[model samples]
Target chain A: MTTTPAADTAVTAAALALGDDALVLSHRLGEWAGHAPVLEEEVALANIALDLLGQARVLLSMAGDEDELAFLREERAFRNLQLVEQPNGDFAHTIARQLYFSVYQHLLHDRLASGDGPFAPLAGKAVKEAAYHRDHAEQWTLRLGDGTDESHARMQAAVDALWRYTGEMFQPVEGIDGVDWPGLESTWRDIVEDVLGRATLTLPEGPRTGAWRAGAGRQGLHTEPFGRMLAEMQHLHRSHPGATW
Target chain B: MVTTTPLEEQLLELAGSVPDPELPVLTLRELGVVRAVRAHGTDSVEVDLTPTYTGCPAVEVMSLDIERVLREHGVREVTVRRVLAPAWSTDDITDEGRRKLREFGIAPPRTGAASGPVRVALGPTRTREGGPADEPEPVRCPHCGSPETELLSRFSSTACKALRRCLACREPFDHFKEL
Candidate 1:
């Protein structure tokens, strides 16, 4: 579709929001390359990370130069949700984060794929990848939430801790058309509730968003951990501009 | 669909003949990634390719191989573009390609189902029952031709394959997952 300049700016904003989400989370997941609890788990996380990275490249390229957008941009300039930049505290915490984000991404992509828009082609492809990611997180959630007393407690704690960041996900992104934000949110909640119920855990009773923090990250206001994460992610590229093997 | 000239058709065949960088046993044609080829003129050609997976690292190598093969065949300028619509599915693999994959000791993906993520049950047997009719067919052992196989890991040596083990023969093998 041909977009006017104003529309193009909105599209760029939307792309940056979604693209930054994928990019930041992929880096966080990649951090488990050496320290994952098991060999298979490590491979699985890396594979998921790679999928997200690929998606980030496509989405970022839609906005501007992919490398410059990923490496040169300052932290405040990023439009990713704060949920993605939260630290991966433990295995359960990571799974919780994955569960929260993958479900939203999958649902969003599913909707986007059905529409004839700028993102249709990408959403058509990425929706499937997001399905696998959602399944992976769901599988882990089931296992950990029901496995043992300590495991169950940890899983519950992780989900609870991450609950506050989730409300930002349902906020309407500009330039994205034909989305049912409330419908999407309700569906997400229902699916999450079903999964948690099946896993023998209860949905957290905590607030979905902290006061004054709704959609903060989309405004380029991120948490403290995000700054440190960006430093590490941007270091090599910043040190040697345009250097390649 | 656009009808191709004989020259474009010939270039398509050459491009499709390039072996997949990750799976040497299968050509790009067999893998269904080489989507379309159009010649801009006598020497310059534009080829449309699709990735098997978004993050498949081998796509770069596959593109390079296609360019090299086409260039060697007297095409002076070759451009490869990645397309994403009508996303690639495991079902896109031709029947001959599936046979070749099985012969190569990897279980080919089960066909005739709409492509999406396979649901995991996490039960002792890890089997799905009473699901919709479109539920995927069982993945048989490439080694023993047994339907009793179990998934070991969703992600394997590559994104397209899943690590599975045959119950009958107890041999670990990779199954090209239904994308």
Candidate 2:
């Protein structure tokens, strides 16, 4: 059966949203390349960043040509969720963000792998990587949370500050349709709760609904920060389209 | 009368012949990454490999390479399975493989030296007392065999390597991390 224009667009948009999340978070993680708390962790974070970058390349490249979808599109035309676009506040914040995002990505990719979609193969490949990322993040979360008093305090502050953004990750965007998968958000919540419990951290209870401060990251509408990130990422490509080393 | 190659001999030869794509000098056999090789029937062979590093990107390419090489050698069907548990390590690099790495300009990793206590220094707001430093240990220069060397970069061309420069030779080379 031929896919209708509307259906194809919806799939394309949903893919872009997912792609943007990977891309922005990859960028944020790249910021920690030389600056991690330890040398081993520096390598670990960079490796994780490279994995996310690879995923972004495949996902975004599939959304359109690698050039147009990543570079030519304007801020509003991009579709990353806001949680990924948020700044990496500190080491603790970065770890907290990773904990939440990796858990969500692992669950989402696990479910998506079984779906009868063209993206299933890609998701299958990504599930393995995401599983490792989740493990890495969870390890850090436990370490920071259960470490000394200073580390514990910093980690708790990070959790409090970033918890609000967690809600948006599970919130489905309108206009990006065709995702009829079931139980993904609940699965995500269960995984997060299990991890948090293991980490010996209490889940912060807050209003799940609030004023949506960050908007349109998934619909190609992104914050000013995304533009800067894209500018840096796309500079080489935009300078010489079709240039190969 | 034509001679038939025994399945064990053929399997051993097939597996022993395949080289790791990333580090060409080491064979899967020498690295101990190749866990098992089995013949399914007269025409099919299965190769099992464990990754040397947790996130080695070359594992996929290496699997495909194994299949291609086996097919070229007349194995009709080949399957490469990646086993995760009992992870491969530098300790698994055979002595011959260690010599090969040294001859190829990359240092063979020191066994049982993968990780140690690392001191990290936080800024003035920091409670930690010391700065980032690994415990003192002799890392022999891969090129000159001198024990004097300094770290140049934690990251190298590949994830498994770190860049270190030898004081004696004054050449930068990739030192395969113990991990």
Candidate 3:
């Protein structure tokens, strides 16, 4: 089957977008290695981070190779959605971010698995893992949401703060042309609503089409925060090119 | 006819005996990681293994172990390959291996279930009481004969198992998911 040049470019961009999301989030989650709220949760978050990193490695490697895709790409060339690139605010905010992104990822992966594209198989493999990520986030969300008043308040504030970023998850980028956008959007709405119901959190309703606080991360245009993130992520690799541990 | 060289037989025996580094009771044969073994034209032996989990640290140790065992059997040049497709599952754990894991104090995962099938079902099976849709069959705690177990953590020592503590025996055991 011959893919038109446009289609090929689009597919490549879509894969990069997906891969970048996993890579950035995996790196962010890795920061919680020994800094989690509890011991059991530290292990759990680490495991989840590793899983995301594993997925990122495969997806990024598939996008190109290990070195080229990871080390070679410039900050402006990245296409991950902004939500993933957002700083892990606090314990409550991190869990809140996990809940939002994992829910989106689970739904996105589930739908993409059935799509008629090269990404289908990758999505199929990743969806199972992402499902667990969503479960982990959901469990934490419930515990935090239903726990003490302080915990509930913190979690609620987190959810509210992160809600603005959720819009971009469903927004279709130019590179992902020919995707089943309607179906994906519907699935995202349904899953997000269900999870929000369980967490006893209200969905923040607003004008869906409004100026984003953070500009486009999907268009290879990222916030200044991404530049700082890249500096730290690439420091060692750039310093010692072709060096291996 | 001279019996097949003791070297060949010994290598085969060593290959057969090397247990999976993750699930130590299960031989790589039972785990289905050992794909093939062949004498590499004379002085060398080639062995292939697939990783049970992506980026599993144990795969490196298992590869080294294979080389050590084969060297002991007077063979050199062991090759281990990481095959990604047809991913490993708890279902691959043989019945005999399951028994061995139980004896070793680490509970073998239940055959056929993925990491947390019951918990995965919890969302769709949400009722007034928050039970599963179709009541999940009792998961026997491999530590004791008790069905009174609670899921303590989903992430265990490995991704394949969940940490469950038995209420009856007060022991934490790995419930191999019924893959």
Candidate 4:
């Protein structure tokens, strides 16, 4: 009853792509639980992660069992961007990653929400939460980038280091609402530039295009870090297969 | 404002009054997220509820709680469905809900004007006093009933709150964010 055959398949593919993005990033943020720099940030990051997890639950459940989709999927089956699966290098790196992903998520959700597509209800709902996620990232980016010398250096390094992975987010996913990716990219660039400039940081010079630009996570391919991360994420659910809490 | 049959009225009096899992102070009815509670065929009842936020984790729990509560009261069949067409808004929180939220130590949703940071279906993100010149004043502290409070952070312990510290009471309170 959820859909016709063709629509279901298309929706499933689109959901998995977007859902994996949120699920993987949620797990990555969950990794910060006991390790974030401060107690407040521990709560804040967890809030954002939980929000993503909730979105992931709805999106993944649209295709199949959320628990199975999240816990049982092999690393290569994941369609998340390589950027999200990257390790939390440091607090600054984490914030930088959040900044990139949340803005894209916000804009993407906004576009989807404006349409009558199947993803609209969820996306319309999700974009608001993504706004907060972006705000959280922006707040810290500004504070860290313009703060003490150590903080500024770390923030700058994090931004520059993660620039390459961002390109994968813009790759067209089949069945997602037809969005103007070129326009989205430009908007993202403008927003990031404004925020980073105000924070006294420069735009990352790393390649985001051409043959050398890092990407390809969309085709169920991922980097080395993802394998390890996925293993850890799946361990608990795998430990007691078929057990329910 | 709710129009229902006598049987539905009986069901709603119980089913609609379920407290929100996150706020706990406001009922689903008072919060206005309970869209409907009526008969769903011969011997079954259905409750329609929407989440405060699309991603609020409490929505599922709230649904489960509603089912549990109704079944415990001898309702043979119950179904909880979530709808998204007419999306939920902070404006839907009733005045009674706001009063209850204050008693529960969380500042209620802003009464009028978009002063708090809330997102909706359309338009650019217009944040509070930062841009909107006609936006209302800051939410008052719930503790001392004072107008003097400093916002500690827009993101708080929960998605629907902003952390505010009262200048009068020196107490950190949760302001139910507009959204």
On lDDT, the candidate that comes out on top is 1
TM-score of 4: 0.91
Chain B superposition TM-score per model = 0.89, 0.79, 0.75, 0.81
- Give the TM-scores of the predictions, in the order they appear: 0.96, 0.61, 0.81, 0.91
Pairs with steric clashes in candidate 4: none
Ranking of all candidate structures by their lDDT, best first: 1, 4, 3, 2
What does candidate 4's lDDT look like per residue over A1-245, in tens digits? 46688877888989998999999999999999899887778878888898898889889988899988899988878888888999999899999999999999999988988888988988867877888788889888989999999999999999998998888777788777679988998999999999999999999985774354444787887878999998898898899898776
- What's the DockQ for every one of the candidates? 0.58, 0.06, 0.26, 0.39
- Candidate 3 per-residue lDDT, tens place, B1-179, comes to 43446656656667868988777778877666776566756678877666655545677788888988887766757776655444455666778887887787766665545543323442221112324666555555676667667777767776656677877878877755433
Better of 1 and 2 by TM-score: 1
Candidate 2 residue A90 Cα shift, in angstroms, is 1.1
List residue ranges in candidate 3 displaced over 4 A: A1-8, A173-179, A207-215, B1-18, B34-51, B59-81, B115-119, B122-133, B177-179
Clashing pairs in 3: B109-B175, B109-B176, B110-B176, B111-B178, B112-B178, B112-B179, B113-B178, B113-B179
Tens-digit lDDT string for candidate 2 (A62-170): 6788667776776777777766876777888898898888888877766666666756756655665676577667767887888888888888888777777776666
Query: What is candidate 2's local distance difference test score?
Result: 0.70
- Relative to the real complex, the DockQ score for model 4 comes to 0.39
Whose DockQ is greatest here?
Answer: 1
Q: Between the candidate structures 2 and 4, which one is better when assessed by TM-score?
A: 4
Between candidates 2 and 4, the DockQ winner? 4
